[model samples]
Target chain A: MWDEKETDRKLCIICSKGTLDMAYPGLVLANAALMEGIDVTIFFTFWGLDMITKREMSNLKFTPIGNPHKMNFGNRTIGIPNAVAGFPGMTNMATSMIKKEMDKLEFPEIPEFLEMITDAGGKLYACRLSTDMFQLHEEDLYEGVEGIVGATDFMELSEDAQIIFI
Target chain B: MTSREIAGKTIEFDEDGFLANPQDWDKDVAQELAHEVGIDELTASHWQVIEFSRSDFDERGEAPTLRRLKVAAGVPTKDLYELFPKKPAKKIAYVSGLGKPHGCI
Candidate 1:
């Protein structure tokens, strides 16, 4: 009932957040969309580029400040209030806990997920403005990153796609 | 739980018509369910998706989301749409007797 047209077949996901937790939604969604045989392109801008950066990619840190507590301890999924996230060493604890839980589920690590997305035929692009502002070179990006693109390029490319911002 | 009678069997379903108990599902049920959703006949390719969906649901204790199905079922989005039409993910989950996957579906 949302629209008379057939379901959208192409998806454009924008990733602007850089935290480890913030990265999964875009990555997992892109992975899922590609699997469904939908064409997917992910635009990583601002801090999001850290996800695809060869130097700082794999060990991206989780910032407990203003982070939502997933409340997952061990294998149990819980929800902790955001207020508690401000305590000392909370970011470290949260990161370790989340990594452990993700590992238990056999989900690929961030680097592996990026590779999987590219291998699965999804496209990855870094924002040109962000790259230039940050002084990052193409050599600083991981393999399979389609060159840095500007806002206009992304909008034109995604004109026919269902846009998702994360 | 709601229900629809298919092939003389009373199969329970959730609000969106996905089979409440996936075990209530069978080939006859799948074919009948497909018809209810506007698929007049189930083709070999359609059966491929249903079989994969059901097996994956059984193995994972969860319905394979479109992403999981892409890897495990080996069917692309284009063909899935051609087979099941609009909202293919939800339709396939219903036709294949699995719960609705979480998200916009």
Candidate 2:
């Protein structure tokens, strides 16, 4: 019986570590899995928790403060490490250019895509510790969020299922 | 309760906002969709976009590039933003079926 359960079990887990580029992959994967009729569960930890919370989700900004992928524009031709790429202002400029290019293509902003996942019956959860660390509350999360859960609780639900940390 | 053509049975939505549907998805995903959006049953506009996009992709043998889709859809650039603000354009085109999903384009 245990073996049978294990064979049929499948789970998708995403741990969003907060690189602007990294955030979307988790969401996209979760949504795609749900469409395939697979049982999916998302566990948000640390900076990843922000995406599920409402106040943070809508106002997310790429921090150029120390981001290493930032482009130094005029100096980009020289290809310096993004960590030393100009200053915060320059980082903002690069991020803006990226946003504009994305805009032209009709990519839905982060929050919109989250809504799509929710509408499609995907389940979302927030980590209690992460929310506490960030000083967030259950009410702060996006509309479709299931609830706050700890690691043990999450693992139990994901027992015998495939776990992916995105 | 009986099956009948209710006034609010279906909805018609376009760039401006929701219209002709009694169901209120406004608080959720529907609000996020700003470009000719439709749900719970297809509308004429939805059919047009789907049909035109499919045909366009079939003829070109490639997804209709963003510029071309905008012109064909008859909406401002901001409209697309409202429709799909998160995923990339290629994924949007595929999801929207503005291009055929299974390799048509």
Candidate 3:
């Protein structure tokens, strides 16, 4: 019953987490929507602001503490206990493992992914409150970010649009 | 399997309107397909993308994603959007007579 030609669909993704694993879902979904000719906007808040933060975007860590899923490493599956996951270097280990898998699958890094989205005409925004709390400025974020806006502005921008929170 | 006449030849298309067989594609077919999608003409830049896509599909057995096009074909992302408009990935696949790209991003 959905008619794409008759309707201009829009998608708004709320990215609230900053983990390497979490950061990708929002970016991937935003890009997918753009590929479908849907208008897309991503709002970054809380730790999610790190996704747009220049210094931290590329170095996001994958914390294994709360992840219960097993990871596959070239025919070997490994599960890290919560205790072991908290140990030093575990985060780095997990991050690198996932990053390698992502690369093998041809997924780009976060900054490049953001660039792809921007090039496709997808809009990116940072939460003003979060920027203030994190002491981040416009200059501290990725150059492609359109603006740092409040919740109300986001609501207006995403009016009648389907929203996904990641 | 549905078929439509393109460039004076009856070409089979998948349920999604993509060419059922990549071998059925030709430059004239591409020009007609591009016109169906609101592209009045296929310029030299368009030919570059189409040629790259066809060769890439022959090697990979699947259509290339926008990222692959940008990285491997030396086409920039902005230029791809300009060439194909609203949905560059799907448009390129459609015009190139290949299956839709399966990558999420």
Query: Candidate 2, residues A1-166: lDDT per residue as tens digits?
Result: 0000112445657666765556767876765554344567788889888777776675455545555443544555323355655665755655566566556655556776666556544578888888888888888887778899887888787887888887
Clashing pairs in 1: A37-B77
lDDT of 3 by residue, B72-99 (tens): 9989999998998887887888889887
Candidate 2 accuracy as TM-score: 0.57
Candidate 1: Cα lDDT at A164? 93
Kindly give the stretch of ten consecutive residues in candidate 3 chain A with the minimal lDDT sum. A1-10
Which one wins on DockQ?
3
Least accurate 10 contiguous residues by lDDT in model 2 chain B:
B16-25
lDDT of each: 0.78, 0.54, 0.89
Per-residue lDDT tens digits of candidate 3, residues A38-109? 999999999999999999999999988988888767689979999899999999999998998999889999
- TM (B chain), model 1: 0.88
lDDT by residue for model 2 over B8-94, one digit each (tens)?
333343322212222322222222332322234434544445445556756765555433455566643344334433322333343
What ranges in model 2 sit over 4 Å off? A1-9, A63-86, B1-53, B56-105
TM-score to true structure, per model: 0.63, 0.57, 0.95
Positional deviation of residue A45's Cα in model 3 after best superposition, in angstroms: 0.2
lDDT of candidate 1 over A7-123, digit per residue (tens): 459999999988888898899888777545688999999999999999888887776566465665658865546777677887787778778777665566788788767766679
> Candidate 2 vs candidate 3: which has greater DockQ?
3
Clashing residue pairs for model 3: none
Q: i-RMS values of the candidates, in order?
A: 6.8, 15.5, 4.2
The chain B TM-scores of all candidates, as shown, are 0.88, 0.41, 0.96
